[model samples]
Target: MKKAIKILFVEDEEALGMVVSDSLRSRGFEIDYHTDGESALQATLTNKYDILVLDVMLPKMDGFSLAREYRKVNRNTPIIFLTARSQTEDVVEGFELGGNDYLKKPFSMEELIVRVKSLIGRLLYSEESQLEECFVGNYKFNIQKQTLELNGKIKTLTYREAQVLLMLFEKRNQVLERKLVLDQLWGDDSFFNARSMDVFITRLRKYLRDDSNIQIVNIRGIGYKLLI
Candidate 1:
Protein backbone atom coordinates (compact mmCIF):
# COMPACT_ATOMS: atom_id res chain seq x y z
CA MET A 1 0.00 0.00 0.00
CA LYS A 2 1.15 3.54 -0.62
CA LYS A 3 1.99 5.45 2.52
CA ALA A 4 0.30 8.70 3.31
CA ILE A 5 2.52 11.75 3.21
CA LYS A 6 3.23 13.13 6.68
CA ILE A 7 3.50 16.87 7.16
CA LEU A 8 4.56 19.13 10.02
CA PHE A 9 2.60 22.32 9.60
CA VAL A 10 3.28 25.33 11.85
CA GLU A 11 1.10 28.38 11.56
CA ASP A 12 0.09 31.01 14.12
CA GLU A 13 -3.10 31.98 12.41
CA GLU A 14 -5.80 29.82 13.97
CA ALA A 15 -8.47 29.96 11.26
CA LEU A 16 -6.07 29.65 8.39
CA GLY A 17 -4.23 26.85 10.08
CA MET A 18 -7.45 24.89 10.54
CA VAL A 19 -8.40 25.39 6.92
CA VAL A 20 -5.03 24.35 5.63
CA SER A 21 -4.77 21.34 7.89
CA ASP A 22 -8.27 20.23 6.99
CA SER A 23 -7.58 20.64 3.33
CA LEU A 24 -4.42 18.58 3.54
CA ARG A 25 -6.08 15.95 5.67
CA SER A 26 -8.91 15.72 3.18
CA ARG A 27 -6.37 15.00 0.51
CA GLY A 28 -4.97 12.02 2.50
CA PHE A 29 -2.05 13.81 4.09
CA GLU A 30 -1.17 13.21 7.73
CA ILE A 31 -0.97 16.72 9.18
CA ASP A 32 0.56 17.60 12.53
CA TYR A 33 -0.28 21.22 13.15
CA HIS A 34 1.26 23.64 15.65
CA THR A 35 0.65 27.24 16.63
CA ASP A 36 4.07 28.13 18.06
CA GLY A 37 7.60 27.56 16.90
CA GLU A 38 8.79 26.10 20.18
CA SER A 39 6.14 23.39 20.16
CA ALA A 40 6.74 22.77 16.49
CA LEU A 41 10.46 22.41 17.05
CA GLN A 42 9.86 19.92 19.81
CA ALA A 43 7.49 17.99 17.61
CA THR A 44 10.09 17.77 14.85
CA LEU A 45 12.84 16.70 17.25
CA THR A 46 10.69 13.83 18.45
CA ASN A 47 8.78 12.84 15.32
CA LYS A 48 9.60 12.33 11.66
CA TYR A 49 7.75 13.92 8.78
CA ASP A 50 7.96 13.83 5.00
CA ILE A 51 7.82 17.63 4.72
CA LEU A 52 7.53 20.88 6.70
CA VAL A 53 5.15 23.76 6.04
CA LEU A 54 6.19 26.71 8.20
CA ASP A 55 4.72 30.18 8.54
CA VAL A 56 7.21 33.02 8.81
CA MET A 57 5.43 34.94 11.58
CA LEU A 58 4.85 33.05 14.79
CA PRO A 59 4.51 33.83 18.50
CA LYS A 60 7.49 32.16 20.15
CA MET A 61 9.83 31.96 17.16
CA ASP A 62 9.75 32.89 13.51
CA GLY A 63 9.94 30.43 10.62
CA PHE A 64 13.42 31.42 9.48
CA SER A 65 14.95 31.11 12.96
CA LEU A 66 13.17 27.84 13.60
CA ALA A 67 14.28 26.45 10.24
CA ARG A 68 17.88 27.45 11.00
CA GLU A 69 17.78 25.54 14.27
CA TYR A 70 15.98 22.58 12.75
CA ARG A 71 18.53 22.28 9.92
CA LYS A 72 21.32 21.82 12.44
CA VAL A 73 19.90 18.35 13.17
CA ASN A 74 17.79 17.37 10.15
CA ARG A 75 18.72 18.34 6.61
CA ASN A 76 16.89 15.72 4.61
CA THR A 77 13.22 16.54 5.03
CA PRO A 78 12.08 19.32 2.69
CA ILE A 79 10.80 22.63 4.08
CA ILE A 80 8.51 25.17 2.40
CA PHE A 81 8.45 28.69 3.80
CA LEU A 82 5.05 30.37 3.99
CA THR A 83 5.18 34.11 4.30
CA ALA A 84 3.16 37.22 3.59
CA ARG A 85 6.26 39.20 2.72
CA SER A 86 7.26 39.12 -0.94
CA GLN A 87 10.65 40.71 -0.59
CA THR A 88 13.35 39.05 -2.68
CA GLU A 89 15.78 39.31 0.22
CA ASP A 90 13.47 37.38 2.52
CA VAL A 91 12.95 34.64 -0.07
CA VAL A 92 16.67 34.44 -0.68
CA GLU A 93 17.32 34.16 3.02
CA GLY A 94 14.81 31.33 3.28
CA PHE A 95 16.54 29.40 0.48
CA GLU A 96 19.99 30.19 1.92
CA LEU A 97 18.82 28.84 5.28
CA GLY A 98 17.89 25.53 3.60
CA GLY A 99 14.23 25.96 2.75
CA ASN A 100 13.22 23.86 -0.24
CA ASP A 101 10.38 26.10 -1.44
CA TYR A 102 8.68 29.40 -0.62
CA LEU A 103 5.02 30.31 -0.89
CA LYS A 104 3.59 33.77 -0.63
CA LYS A 105 0.58 34.28 1.61
CA PRO A 106 -2.97 34.30 0.22
CA PHE A 107 -1.92 31.54 -2.16
CA SER A 108 -4.43 29.22 -3.65
CA MET A 109 -5.02 25.82 -2.10
CA GLU A 110 -4.27 24.24 -5.45
CA GLU A 111 -0.90 25.99 -5.64
CA LEU A 112 0.06 24.88 -2.15
CA ILE A 113 -0.96 21.34 -2.98
CA VAL A 114 1.07 21.36 -6.16
CA ARG A 115 4.16 22.74 -4.41
CA VAL A 116 3.93 20.18 -1.64
CA LYS A 117 3.58 17.31 -4.11
CA SER A 118 6.52 18.61 -6.09
CA LEU A 119 8.77 18.70 -3.05
CA ILE A 120 7.71 15.25 -1.92
CA GLY A 121 8.46 13.88 -5.37
CA ARG A 122 11.88 15.52 -5.23
CA LEU A 123 12.87 13.81 -1.98
CA LEU A 124 16.50 12.68 -1.98
CA TYR A 125 15.74 9.47 -0.17
CA SER A 126 17.87 7.34 -2.41
CA GLU A 127 20.12 7.47 -5.47
CA GLU A 128 22.71 5.14 -4.09
CA SER A 129 24.55 1.88 -4.90
CA GLN A 130 23.71 2.16 -8.56
CA LEU A 131 27.35 1.49 -9.47
CA GLU A 132 28.66 0.15 -6.17
CA GLU A 133 31.59 2.56 -6.07
CA CYS A 134 33.52 5.05 -8.16
CA PHE A 135 37.10 6.25 -8.01
CA VAL A 136 37.60 10.02 -8.00
CA GLY A 137 41.30 10.81 -7.98
CA ASN A 138 42.54 9.78 -4.51
CA TYR A 139 39.06 9.35 -3.06
CA LYS A 140 36.82 6.29 -3.11
CA PHE A 141 33.19 7.25 -3.27
CA ASN A 142 30.73 4.63 -1.99
CA ILE A 143 27.40 5.64 -3.38
CA GLN A 144 25.40 3.22 -1.28
CA LYS A 145 26.89 4.36 2.01
CA GLN A 146 27.07 8.00 0.98
CA THR A 147 30.67 8.17 2.14
CA LEU A 148 33.97 9.32 0.67
CA GLU A 149 37.09 7.54 1.81
CA LEU A 150 40.44 9.28 1.63
CA ASN A 151 43.59 7.72 3.08
CA GLY A 152 42.18 6.28 6.32
CA LYS A 153 39.23 8.64 6.82
CA ILE A 154 35.61 8.28 5.76
CA LYS A 155 33.42 11.37 5.55
CA THR A 156 29.67 10.96 5.44
CA LEU A 157 27.48 13.11 3.22
CA THR A 158 23.94 14.40 3.52
CA TYR A 159 21.41 12.82 1.16
CA ARG A 160 21.25 15.88 -1.07
CA GLU A 161 25.03 16.20 -1.12
CA ALA A 162 25.42 12.56 -1.98
CA GLN A 163 22.83 12.83 -4.72
CA VAL A 164 24.63 15.81 -6.22
CA LEU A 165 27.95 13.99 -6.16
CA LEU A 166 26.38 10.93 -7.71
CA MET A 167 24.95 13.01 -10.54
CA LEU A 168 28.31 14.58 -11.24
CA PHE A 169 29.98 11.19 -11.29
CA GLU A 170 27.36 9.79 -13.64
CA LYS A 171 27.87 12.70 -16.01
CA ARG A 172 31.62 12.92 -15.65
CA ASN A 173 33.45 14.86 -18.39
CA GLN A 174 30.18 16.36 -19.63
CA VAL A 175 28.23 19.48 -18.83
CA LEU A 176 25.38 18.64 -16.46
CA GLU A 177 22.83 21.29 -17.22
CA ARG A 178 21.89 23.58 -14.34
CA LYS A 179 18.22 23.22 -15.20
CA LEU A 180 18.37 19.44 -15.04
CA VAL A 181 20.09 19.43 -11.64
CA LEU A 182 17.78 22.05 -10.18
CA ASP A 183 14.65 20.45 -11.56
CA GLN A 184 15.56 16.92 -10.55
CA LEU A 185 16.91 17.73 -7.10
CA TRP A 186 14.87 20.78 -6.09
CA GLY A 187 11.65 20.21 -8.07
CA ASP A 188 12.09 23.55 -9.83
CA ASP A 189 14.67 25.79 -11.48
CA SER A 190 13.83 29.05 -9.82
CA PHE A 191 16.51 31.65 -9.03
CA PHE A 192 16.46 30.62 -5.37
CA ASN A 193 16.99 26.98 -6.28
CA ALA A 194 19.76 27.93 -8.71
CA ARG A 195 21.59 29.68 -5.88
CA SER A 196 21.20 26.63 -3.70
CA MET A 197 22.61 24.39 -6.44
CA ASP A 198 25.67 26.65 -6.70
CA VAL A 199 26.21 26.25 -2.98
CA PHE A 200 26.07 22.47 -3.28
CA ILE A 201 28.52 22.50 -6.18
CA THR A 202 30.95 24.57 -4.12
CA ARG A 203 30.67 22.12 -1.26
CA LEU A 204 31.31 19.16 -3.54
CA ARG A 205 34.36 20.91 -4.99
CA LYS A 206 35.73 21.42 -1.50
CA TYR A 207 35.19 17.78 -0.69
CA LEU A 208 37.07 16.68 -3.78
CA ARG A 209 39.85 19.27 -3.59
CA ASP A 210 42.49 16.80 -2.36
CA ASP A 211 42.87 15.58 -5.95
CA SER A 212 44.56 18.27 -8.01
CA ASN A 213 43.48 16.71 -11.31
CA ILE A 214 39.81 16.71 -10.36
CA GLN A 215 37.81 19.69 -11.48
CA ILE A 216 34.17 20.78 -11.58
CA VAL A 217 34.49 23.26 -14.36
CA ASN A 218 31.85 25.92 -14.91
CA ILE A 219 30.60 26.14 -18.50
CA ARG A 220 30.11 29.91 -18.29
CA GLY A 221 26.48 30.18 -19.43
CA ILE A 222 25.54 26.51 -19.24
CA GLY A 223 26.33 24.22 -16.28
CA TYR A 224 29.19 22.24 -14.69
CA LYS A 225 31.61 19.72 -16.10
CA LEU A 226 33.18 17.15 -13.81
CA LEU A 227 36.63 16.26 -15.11
CA ILE A 228 39.15 13.91 -13.63
Candidate 2:
Protein backbone atom coordinates (compact mmCIF):
# COMPACT_ATOMS: atom_id res chain seq x y z
CA MET A 1 0.00 0.00 0.00
CA LYS A 2 1.13 3.53 -0.75
CA LYS A 3 2.07 5.50 2.32
CA ALA A 4 -0.33 8.32 3.19
CA ILE A 5 1.08 11.82 3.29
CA LYS A 6 0.91 13.55 6.67
CA ILE A 7 0.10 17.23 7.18
CA LEU A 8 0.06 19.57 10.17
CA PHE A 9 -2.71 22.04 9.46
CA VAL A 10 -3.31 25.07 11.67
CA GLU A 11 -6.39 27.23 11.20
CA ASP A 12 -8.50 29.18 13.66
CA GLU A 13 -11.72 29.27 11.72
CA GLU A 14 -13.68 26.23 12.85
CA ALA A 15 -15.94 25.85 9.81
CA LEU A 16 -13.21 26.39 7.25
CA GLY A 17 -10.81 24.14 9.14
CA MET A 18 -13.31 21.32 9.21
CA VAL A 19 -14.00 21.56 5.52
CA VAL A 20 -10.32 21.71 4.58
CA SER A 21 -9.11 19.02 6.93
CA ASP A 22 -11.95 16.72 6.01
CA SER A 23 -11.25 17.32 2.35
CA LEU A 24 -7.55 16.52 2.78
CA ARG A 25 -8.22 13.44 4.86
CA SER A 26 -10.60 12.18 2.21
CA ARG A 27 -7.79 12.46 -0.33
CA GLY A 28 -5.51 10.04 1.59
CA PHE A 29 -3.71 12.65 3.66
CA GLU A 30 -3.22 12.13 7.39
CA ILE A 31 -4.16 15.45 8.97
CA ASP A 32 -3.36 16.85 12.39
CA TYR A 33 -5.52 19.94 12.63
CA HIS A 34 -5.01 22.61 15.28
CA THR A 35 -6.88 25.83 16.13
CA ASP A 36 -4.06 27.72 17.81
CA GLY A 37 -0.44 28.46 17.05
CA GLU A 38 0.98 27.49 20.44
CA SER A 39 -0.24 23.94 20.20
CA ALA A 40 0.89 23.81 16.61
CA LEU A 41 4.37 24.82 17.66
CA GLN A 42 4.42 22.02 20.20
CA ALA A 43 3.26 19.56 17.60
CA THR A 44 6.02 20.65 15.27
CA LEU A 45 8.71 20.00 17.89
CA THR A 46 7.45 16.52 18.68
CA ASN A 47 6.12 15.30 15.36
CA LYS A 48 7.51 15.24 11.84
CA TYR A 49 5.09 15.98 9.06
CA ASP A 50 5.62 16.04 5.33
CA ILE A 51 4.28 19.62 5.18
CA LEU A 52 2.71 22.27 7.33
CA VAL A 53 -0.36 24.38 6.39
CA LEU A 54 -0.62 27.44 8.62
CA ASP A 55 -3.19 30.20 8.75
CA VAL A 56 -1.94 33.77 9.08
CA MET A 57 -4.13 34.50 12.05
CA LEU A 58 -4.58 32.26 15.09
CA PRO A 59 -5.17 32.38 18.81
CA LYS A 60 -2.27 32.65 21.34
CA MET A 61 0.24 33.29 18.54
CA ASP A 62 0.25 34.37 14.91
CA GLY A 63 1.26 32.04 12.12
CA PHE A 64 4.32 34.06 11.08
CA SER A 65 5.88 33.78 14.55
CA LEU A 66 5.07 30.12 14.70
CA ALA A 67 6.73 29.47 11.38
CA ARG A 68 9.71 31.59 12.38
CA GLU A 69 10.26 29.54 15.53
CA TYR A 70 9.70 26.32 13.68
CA ARG A 71 12.37 27.24 11.13
CA LYS A 72 15.01 27.67 13.82
CA VAL A 73 15.04 23.90 14.38
CA ASN A 74 13.77 22.30 11.18
CA ARG A 75 14.35 23.87 7.78
CA ASN A 76 13.59 20.80 5.70
CA THR A 77 9.83 20.40 5.92
CA PRO A 78 7.83 22.65 3.61
CA ILE A 79 5.34 25.20 4.95
CA ILE A 80 2.36 26.84 3.27
CA PHE A 81 0.49 29.83 4.65
CA LEU A 82 -3.26 30.20 4.42
CA THR A 83 -3.89 33.88 4.73
CA ALA A 84 -6.43 36.59 3.94
CA ARG A 85 -3.67 39.16 3.64
CA SER A 86 -2.81 39.34 -0.05
CA GLN A 87 -0.53 42.36 0.14
CA THR A 88 2.88 41.87 -1.42
CA GLU A 89 4.74 42.68 1.80
CA ASP A 90 2.65 40.20 3.71
CA VAL A 91 3.41 37.56 1.13
CA VAL A 92 7.10 38.43 1.20
CA GLU A 93 7.17 38.28 4.99
CA GLY A 94 5.70 34.82 4.96
CA PHE A 95 8.36 33.56 2.59
CA GLU A 96 11.06 35.22 4.68
CA LEU A 97 9.63 33.46 7.68
CA GLY A 98 10.33 30.14 5.95
CA GLY A 99 7.10 29.50 4.13
CA ASN A 100 7.30 27.55 0.90
CA ASP A 101 3.95 28.60 -0.62
CA TYR A 102 1.34 31.17 0.33
CA LEU A 103 -2.32 30.62 -0.39
CA LYS A 104 -4.64 33.51 0.24
CA LYS A 105 -8.03 33.07 1.87
CA PRO A 106 -11.05 31.94 -0.12
CA PHE A 107 -8.83 29.55 -2.07
CA SER A 108 -10.42 26.46 -3.51
CA MET A 109 -9.60 23.09 -2.02
CA GLU A 110 -8.33 21.96 -5.43
CA GLU A 111 -5.74 24.76 -5.54
CA LEU A 112 -4.61 23.99 -2.00
CA ILE A 113 -4.35 20.31 -2.79
CA VAL A 114 -2.34 21.01 -5.90
CA ARG A 115 0.11 23.20 -3.99
CA VAL A 116 0.49 20.59 -1.25
CA LYS A 117 1.24 17.85 -3.73
CA SER A 118 3.58 20.04 -5.72
CA LEU A 119 5.63 20.97 -2.67
CA ILE A 120 5.86 17.37 -1.51
CA GLY A 121 6.84 16.25 -4.99
CA ARG A 122 9.66 18.77 -5.10
CA LEU A 123 10.80 17.79 -1.61
CA LEU A 124 10.93 14.10 -2.47
CA TYR A 125 12.71 14.78 -5.74
CA SER A 126 15.35 16.93 -4.04
CA GLU A 127 16.11 14.20 -1.50
CA GLU A 128 17.52 12.01 -4.31
CA SER A 129 21.27 11.40 -4.00
CA GLN A 130 23.31 14.23 -5.53
CA LEU A 131 26.68 15.81 -5.11
CA GLU A 132 26.86 17.59 -1.75
CA GLU A 133 29.90 19.69 -2.57
CA CYS A 134 31.37 21.32 -5.69
CA PHE A 135 34.33 23.47 -6.60
CA VAL A 136 33.48 27.07 -7.47
CA GLY A 137 36.55 28.80 -8.91
CA ASN A 138 38.96 27.05 -6.49
CA TYR A 139 36.61 27.39 -3.56
CA LYS A 140 34.88 24.29 -2.27
CA PHE A 141 31.18 24.91 -1.72
CA ASN A 142 29.12 22.54 0.38
CA ILE A 143 25.41 22.91 -0.22
CA GLN A 144 24.24 21.07 2.87
CA LYS A 145 26.83 22.47 5.28
CA GLN A 146 26.41 26.01 3.91
CA THR A 147 30.15 26.47 3.90
CA LEU A 148 32.70 27.77 1.42
CA GLU A 149 36.35 26.88 1.79
CA LEU A 150 39.48 28.26 0.15
CA ASN A 151 43.03 27.26 0.96
CA GLY A 152 42.09 25.64 4.30
CA LYS A 153 40.09 28.71 5.40
CA ILE A 154 36.34 28.21 5.73
CA LYS A 155 33.65 30.86 5.75
CA THR A 156 30.21 29.73 6.82
CA LEU A 157 27.36 31.44 5.00
CA THR A 158 24.03 32.73 6.18
CA TYR A 159 21.02 30.80 4.92
CA ARG A 160 20.00 33.42 2.36
CA GLU A 161 23.56 33.78 1.11
CA ALA A 162 23.90 30.03 0.74
CA GLN A 163 20.59 29.82 -1.11
CA VAL A 164 21.57 32.58 -3.56
CA LEU A 165 25.02 31.12 -4.08
CA LEU A 166 23.59 27.64 -4.66
CA MET A 167 21.24 28.97 -7.32
CA LEU A 168 24.05 30.78 -9.08
CA PHE A 169 26.40 27.79 -8.87
CA GLU A 170 23.71 25.46 -10.19
CA LYS A 171 23.43 27.59 -13.32
CA ARG A 172 27.09 28.48 -13.56
CA ASN A 173 28.24 29.99 -16.87
CA GLN A 174 24.63 30.84 -17.68
CA VAL A 175 22.42 33.86 -17.30
CA LEU A 176 20.26 33.70 -14.20
CA GLU A 177 17.39 36.14 -14.38
CA ARG A 178 17.16 38.67 -11.52
CA LYS A 179 13.40 38.26 -11.29
CA LEU A 180 13.75 34.53 -10.86
CA VAL A 181 16.19 34.92 -7.97
CA LEU A 182 13.99 37.46 -6.24
CA ASP A 183 10.90 35.33 -6.73
CA GLN A 184 12.66 32.23 -5.43
CA LEU A 185 14.30 33.90 -2.43
CA TRP A 186 12.14 36.89 -1.58
CA GLY A 187 8.92 35.63 -3.10
CA ASP A 188 8.66 38.85 -5.13
CA ASP A 189 10.57 41.20 -7.42
CA SER A 190 9.64 44.46 -5.78
CA PHE A 191 12.03 47.44 -5.52
CA PHE A 192 13.03 46.56 -1.97
CA ASN A 193 13.76 42.96 -2.85
CA ALA A 194 15.81 44.05 -5.87
CA ARG A 195 17.99 46.27 -3.72
CA SER A 196 18.34 43.47 -1.18
CA MET A 197 19.56 41.09 -3.88
CA ASP A 198 22.06 43.69 -5.01
CA VAL A 199 23.47 43.79 -1.51
CA PHE A 200 23.80 40.03 -1.50
CA ILE A 201 25.48 40.01 -4.90
CA THR A 202 27.99 42.58 -3.70
CA ARG A 203 28.70 40.52 -0.61
CA LEU A 204 29.16 37.40 -2.73
CA ARG A 205 31.61 39.22 -4.93
CA LYS A 206 33.63 40.29 -1.91
CA TYR A 207 33.70 36.70 -0.70
CA LEU A 208 34.94 35.40 -4.07
CA ARG A 209 37.40 38.21 -4.82
CA ASP A 210 40.33 35.95 -4.02
CA ASP A 211 39.44 33.79 -7.02
CA SER A 212 40.59 36.03 -9.88
CA ASN A 213 39.05 33.71 -12.44
CA ILE A 214 35.53 33.96 -10.99
CA GLN A 215 33.26 36.82 -11.93
CA ILE A 216 29.57 37.38 -11.35
CA VAL A 217 28.84 39.63 -14.32
CA ASN A 218 25.93 41.99 -14.28
CA ILE A 219 24.16 41.91 -17.64
CA ARG A 220 22.79 45.46 -17.67
CA GLY A 221 19.00 45.78 -17.73
CA ILE A 222 18.72 42.03 -17.81
CA GLY A 223 20.09 39.67 -15.11
CA TYR A 224 23.42 38.26 -13.97
CA LYS A 225 25.73 35.67 -15.41
CA LEU A 226 28.17 33.63 -13.38
CA LEU A 227 31.27 33.74 -15.57
CA ILE A 228 33.62 31.20 -14.09
Candidate 1: tens digits of C-alpha lDDT, residues 1-228: 889999999999999999999999999999999999999999988899999999999989899999989988887678999999866677767866768778888998899888888877756445322476888778999876668999988887755677788898889999999888887766678876677778788888999888899999999879999998
Candidate 2 overall lDDT versus native: 0.84
For candidate 1, report its TM-score: 0.79
State how far residue 69 of model 1 sits from its true place (Å).
4.0
Model 1 alpha-carbon drift over 4 Å, by segment? 71-73, 84-98, 124-134, 142-149, 152-159
For candidate 2, report its TM-score.
0.78
**Winning model by TM-score:** 1
TM-scores across all candidates?
Answer: 0.79, 0.78
User: Residue 156 in model 2: shift from native, Å?
Assistant: 6.6
Give lDDT per model, in order. 0.85, 0.84
Q: After superposition, how far is residue 30 of candidate 2 from its true place, in Å?
A: 0.8
lDDT (10s digit) by residue, model 2, range 110-189: 88898888778866765663967899999999877768999999987655677788889888999999999887665568
